[model samples]
Target: MESNLINKDEEVIRRSKTEIVLKLLEYLKPYKLKSFIVILLMIIVMICGIINPLLLEIAIDNYVVNKNVEGLMIIGAALVIINLIAWILSKIRWTMITSVTNNILVNIRHQLYSHIQTLSFDFFDSRPVGKILARVVGDVNALKNLFSQSIQSFIPQLLNLVCVAVIMFILNFKLALACTILLPILGIAMFYIEIHSRRRWEVYRNKRSNLNGFTHEDFSGIKVVQGFAREKETEKNFKAMVKELGDAFIKAVKLNDFFWPLVELSWGAGTLVVFFVGYKLITNNEIKIGTLIAFLMYVGMFWRPIMNLSNFYNTLITNFSAADRIFDILDVKPVIKNSKNAKNIGKIHGTVEFKNVSFSYDDNTEVLKNVSFKVNKGERIALVGPTGAGKSTIISLLSRFYDPTSGEILIDGKNIKYVDLESLRSQMGIMLQDTFLFSTTIMENIRYGRLDASDEEVIAAAKAVNAHDFIMKLEKGYHTEVNERGSRLSLGQRQLVSFARALLANPRILILDEATSNIDTETEKLVQSGIEKLLYSRTSFVVAHRLSTIRDCDKIMVIDNGRIAELGNHDELIRKKGIYYDLYMTQYKFLNE
Candidate 1:
C-alpha cells in the first residue's frame, strides 16, 4: 500500500505545472470582469509608484536646489495626493480580487465534492475515508492563497518589475545596465531552487494526508483501542506519524527560507553596483546628485517587485501540489455511471434475474463465478452462506452498486445496466449488517428513508418495526437526539431504527443482509415478526446465518465458494440432507447443547 501511494505521488509530481495552472484558470473565467477591474486598478497604482521617484528628482534638481520654495511645496502636495489616490485604488483592488478568489474556491470545492459522490464503491473501498477527507477539505483549502496571491500579488508585482526596469533605463541606461547584470544569475538560482522546493512541498502534502488518515481511523475506532488497552500503543503510532509530518514540513520550509535571503542578496548586490557606477558618472559631471538619488530609489523599487514575485512563485510551488491533487480527483471518471442511452426504469415489479453473472473486486480474484438466479415478484428468498461465499456480492450486483464483470442483471425484464441508477435504486430498500445513523433526532433519522414522510408516517413505520415502544420510553420519544452512527443507542435499538427506516421507504424490493444479527434473541423475535410483515407483497432477499430465523422463508439456498451448493424449501432441503441440512443441524445442535 505504501509503495502504491509513493507511485501515485510521483505521478502527480510528473504532471506539468502548466497543466495545473491552466486548469486553475478555468475557475477564474466566471469572474473575468471583476478580475479585469482588479488588474486596471493595479496598473493605476503602479503608475503612481513610478511617478513618485521622478517627482522627487524634479523637486530636488529644479526647485530645492534653486531656493524655489513654492515650486517645492506644489511638488510635495502633488506627491501626497497621488499616493492617497494609489492607496485607495489598492484597497478596492484587494477587495475585488478577494471576492473573485473566494468565488473560485467555492466553485472548485463544490465541483470536487459533487464528483466524489458519483464515484463507485471501488474507488472508496481502495482508500481510507480520512485520506479522502483530506483531499476534499485540506487540499482544497491550500489553494485559497494560490488564487488570491496570483491576482492580487503575482500579476501586479510582475508588471511592477517590468515598469520599474523600463523607467530605470529611460533615466540612466549605464546605471540600469550595471544594476541588472546579476538578474540572469538570480533567475537561474531560483529556477533550480523551485524545482527542488516543489518536490518537498508535495512530500509534505502526502505526509499530511497520511497523518489525517491515521487520526481519523484512530479516533473512529477509539472504542476498540480503549477496550483492548491499546491506548499507549495507538498514541505511540500517532506521535510517529505527527513527527513524520513535522519533518516533511520543516524540509519544505527550509527550501522556502532560502528563497528570501537569495533575493535580498541580489538586491543588496544591485544596490552596490548602482552606487559604484553612479559615483563614476557623477565624477564625469554626466548626472546630478538628484538624478543619482532617484536612481538609488529605482534600484530599491526594482528589487521590491523581484522579492514580491519570488514570494508569489514560492506560493505557487508550495500550493501547486494541492491544485494537482484536487484536479486528480476531478479527472477521475466514475466507472459506474448512467450510460448515454440509459432511461429510467420507473417503478420496477420486483422480478430479479441474474443470468450467468460473474464478478471480481480486482483482477486477480473472482468473488463470484457463473452465478445464475431468478426470483418472481413478491417471493421471500433466504440466502444461507459461509463467510465470503459471495452472498453479499449478489445483493450488491442486484442493487447495481457494482456491475457484473460478465453477464446481465435484469429487473422487471429490463437490463439494469441500461436503467437510470436513481430510478432503479428508488424502488429498492437495503439494510446492511452495519447500521449508520446521522447525528440527529430518531424521528429525523427514520425520515431519511423517505424525506417527504410526515411525523405520523415516521411513527407508523417505527411501530411496524417494533421500534416505537422503546423510542417512546426515551425522554423525548421519537425526538430524542442521537450521536453519529447512533452511538447513544444500544446495538439492538440502532438495528430497530434501521429496520424502521427501511420499512418507511416502502420499496418494491427489500433486502436484509444480516439485518437482525446484532439484536438479542428476544428483540430478534420482535424484529422477525416485523420482518415477516415487511416482506409481505414484496420481493425480498434475506441473508442470514441463523437458520432458525430463516426457516419460514419460501426458499433457502446454501451458497458455497461462489456457487449455489443447494436450493430448496427447508423441508425439501432437510429431506435431501445436503449443505443446507448440515448447516441447519449444526446450529440446531449448538442451541440444544
Candidate 2:
C-alpha cells in the first residue's frame, strides 16, 4: 500500500554512523591478539609492496646505465627475489584478513540475533519485517566490511601509497607536488560525494528492504491471495515496488557517477604534468632520467589503492548506517522485560479476575469498555462472540500479550502484571486459529509444549488427541518431518498435532481457540474429549465457532460488541431465548435434525 512506504523524510537520512563503529571496534577488543597479528601482516605487505618501484629504478639506472652485462644479471636476480618476497607476504595477508573477516562476521550475526530475541513482543509489534531484516542481513554485512575486511585492505594499500608519496618527494619535490595536487582535490571531491551519496545509498538500502518485506509478506500469505483470487492485483502492486526500487538504485549510482572517472582522469592529468615536469628537470640536469622513470612507476603503482579508497570511503559510511539500524533495535527499551528485583515464577493456582478492565491500543476509542469477569480453578468458561466482539482481546489480556489500559487482571490473588511472565505463560496453553508448527519432526514439535517431556509422554499426548493413529500411518511415523510451517501436513492434521502439543503442556490455564474447527465431526468428538481431560483440573477459556464445542462448558458468556449480553449453561440460555438462543438456533439447529 502507498500508505506503508516511507514518507520521504530527509530527517531519516542520518550522517555516517561513527559511534557504533567505535563501539564495534570496542567489541573487537576481545580479539586483540588476532587483530594485532593482522596489523603485523599489513605492515609486512606494505613494506614489500613499496619495494617494487625501487627495484624498477635499480634495474634501469644501476644496471642498464652502466651497460655492464654482469651488473644487469645481478640486478635482475635481486628484482626476482623482491617479487617473490612480496608475493609470499601478500598471500599471507590475504589469507589472514579473509579468515578473520568471516569469523568476525559470524560472531556479530549470532550476537545480533541473540540480542533480538531478548527484546519484548511490543517492539516486534510496531516494526515491519522488511525493515527489521534490512538491519539483520544488510547492515550486518556492512559492519563486516568496515570492521574486518575494510581495515586490512585499506590499511595496507594506504600505507603503500604514503610510502610511495614519500619516495616521490625525496626524488623530486617539484614533480611530486605537481603529482600530489590531485590527492587533496580528489579527497575533497570524495568527501562531498560521500556525504551526498550516503543518504541516497541509505534510501536504496531501505527500498531494497521494503522489497524484501513485500516479498516476505506476499509469499507468507500466498494461500490467502489465492483464496481471494487477487494474484493479479498483488502482482501489480509488487511490480510498482520493483519499478520504484529500480529508480532508487539508479539514483544511488548517479549520486557518485562521476567519482571513479574524475579520480582516474585527475590521476591521468597529474601523471602527464609529472612527465612534463620531469622532462624540464632532466633538461637542467637536476634529476636523473632513471629517477623520473621510477617516480612514474610509483605513481601508477598507487593509483588503484587511492581509487579503491573512494569506494571504501563511501562503504565506511554505509557500514555506520548499518550500525545505526542495529542500534535502533538495541536501543528499544523492552516494555516487559524482568524488573530489577524480578523473582522467579512459582506454581500457579489459576484464579483469574479482570477488575473494570478497559483497553485501547493507542489514545483513541476504547476497544474493551470496562469489562470485568472472574473464573475460579477447574472452571470451563466459553467466550462466544461475533468477530471483533473482544473475545480474543480478553484472552490476550489474560495471557499478558498486551497490558490493559486501565484496571488490573489478577491471577489467584497476585496481579498478573506482577506475576513473572514466564511462569504465567508456562501455566497457560493456547492453540490459535492458524496453527504454527516448526520445520522439525512431529515428535519434537509436540515435545516443544514441554521441552523436558519424554518420548513416551509425547506419544501419550498425541494418543489423547487422537492424532497418534494418523501420525503412525505416516512412513516415518512420529519422526516424520513437518517441513517449514507444517507444509508437510494437512490443515486438520496440523490442528490435531497442535492439540497434542497443548495436551503435553498440561497447563493450569488452557485457552482453546477453534481447536477442532478444521477437523471433521468424528475427530472433533475425539479431540473434544481429549480437551476435557486436559482441562479437568485447570481453568479454561474456550473460543469456538461451532456451538457444539462449548455446549459442555461449565458456563457460556455471550459477548456482544465488547459487553457481556448473557451468561448461563446451554439448556438454561436456550430456555431464556436470548441472543445465545437465537444464534444457537440459527447456527447449530442441524444437531436437532
Candidate 3:
C-alpha cells in the first residue's frame, strides 16, 4: 500500500502535471464573468502602481529641481488621491475575487464528495479511510489558496511585471537592457528549483498520507493494542511514521528556501547594474536625473513582481502535488455501475437467481466458481461453510456490492447489472455479524434504515426485533447514545438493533450473515422470533452458526471450496450423510459439550 502511494510511473507523472492543472482551472469557467471583471480591476490597479513612481519622478525632477513649491504641492496631492483610489479598487477586487474563487472551491469539493459515493466497494477495499479523508479534506483545503489568490495576486503581479518592463524600455533603452539581463538567469534558476522541489513535495504528501493511515489504523484498534500490552510497540511505530513524515517535509522546505535568496540576489544584481549604467549616463548628460531615478524605481518595481510571481509559482508547485492526488481519486471509474441502458424495475418480487455466477476479488483469486442457485419469492435458505469457503461472497454479490466476473445475477428474471443501482439496493436489507452503529442516539441510528420513518414506526420496528425491551432498560430508552460503533452496547444487543434497522427498511430480500452467532441461547430464542417476523413473505439468505436456523430453513446447502458439496434439509442431509451431515453433527456435538 505504501509503495503504491509513493511510486508513480514516469509517463503517469508527466501526464498528470498537465492534466491536474487543466482540471483545476476548469472550475473557473462557471464564474468567468466575475473573473474577467477581476482581471480588469487588476489592470487598473497595476496602472495606478505604475503611475505612482512616475509621479514621484516628475515631482523630484521638475518641481523640486525648479524650486516650484506650488507644483510640488499639486503633484503631491495628486499622488495621495491616486493611491487612495487604487486602494479602494483593490479592496473591491479582493472581495469580488474571493467570492468567485470560494464558490468554485465549494463546488469542486462537493463534486468530489459526490463522485466518491458512486465508487465501487472494491475501491474502498484498496484504500484506508485516513488516506481518503486526506484527499477529501486536506488536499481540497490546500487548493483554497490557489483559487482565492490566483486572481488577486498572480495576475496583478504578472501585469505589473509586463508594465514595468515596457516602461523601463521606454524610459531609457540602454539602462533597461542592462537592468533586465538578470531576468532570464533568475527565471532559469527558479525553474530548476521548482522541478526539484515538486518531487520533494510529492514525497512529503505521500508520507503525510502514510502517517494518517497509520494513525487511523492504530486508534481504531487501540483496544487490541492495550489488551495485548503492545502500547510501547504501537507508540514506537507511530513515532517512526511521524519522523518519516517530518523528514520528508524538512527536505521539501530546504529546497523551497532557495527561492527567496535567489530572488534577493537577482534583484540586487539588477539594481546595481542599473545604478552603475545610469550614473555613467548621467555624468555624460545622456539622460536626465528624473529618468535615471525612474529607471531605478522601475527596476525595483520589476523585481517586486518577479518575487511575487516566484512565490505564486512556489505555491502552485506545492499544491499541484495535492491536486494530482485528488484527481487520481476522481479518475478512478467504479468497477460496479449501471449500464447505459439500465432499467429501473421500480419494485421486485424478491425471486433471486444466480446463473452459473463466478467471481474473484482481483480477477486473480477466484472466490466463487460457476455457482448456480435459485430462490423463490418467500423461501429462506441457509448456507453452511468453513471460513474462506465463499459463503459471505455470495451475499455480497446478491447485494450487488460487487459484480461477478462471469455469468449473471438476476432478480425477478431481470439481470441485476441492467438495473438502476439505487432502486435495486433500496429493496434489500443486509445485517452483518459485526453490526456497526453510528455515534448518535439509537432512535436516529434506527431511522437510518428508512430516513423518513416516524418515531412510533421506529419504536415498533425495535419491538418487532425484540430490541425494545433492552433499549428501554437504558436511562434514555430509544434516545440513548450508541457511541462510536456502539461501544456502549453488548455484541448481541448491537445485533438486535441492526435487526431492528433492517426490519424498519421492510425490504423484499434480506441477508443475515451469522446474525445469531454471538447471542446466548436465551437471547437467541428472542432474536429467532424477530428473525421469523423479518423473513415472513421475503426471500432470505442465512449463514448460521447454530443448529436451530439451519434445521428450520427451507433448504440447507453445505458449501466447500466454492462449490455446493451438499444441499438438503437437516433430516435429508443427515440421511444422505454427506458434508452437511458432518457439519450438523459437529455443531450439535459442540453445543452439547
Winning candidate number (lDDT): 1
> Per-model C-alpha lDDT, please?
0.89, 0.79, 0.86
Q: What TM-score does each of the candidates earn?
A: 0.97, 0.88, 0.96
Alpha-carbon lDDT of model 1 = 0.89
lDDT of 3 by residue, 481-549 (tens): 988999999999998999999999999999989887888877888888898899999999999766667
Model 1 lDDT per residue over 48-124, tens place: 99999999999999998899999999999999999999999999988997788878888888999999999988778
The per-candidate count of clashes, in order, stands at 0, 0, 0
What's the residue-level lDDT of 221 in candidate 3? 89
- Comparing 2 and 3 on TM-score, the stronger one: 3
User: What's the C-alpha lDDT at position 76 in model 2?
Assistant: 76
Off by over 4 Å in 1: 1-13
Stronger candidate by lDDT (1 vs 2): 1
- Encode model 2's per-residue lDDT on 172-270: one tens digit a residue: 789889888777777887778777777777676667777777787788889899999999998987898788789987998786777878789888988
Predicted structure 2, TM vs. truth? 0.88
Name the candidate, 2 or 3, with the larger lDDT value: 3
Which scores higher on TM-score, 1 or 2?
Answer: 1
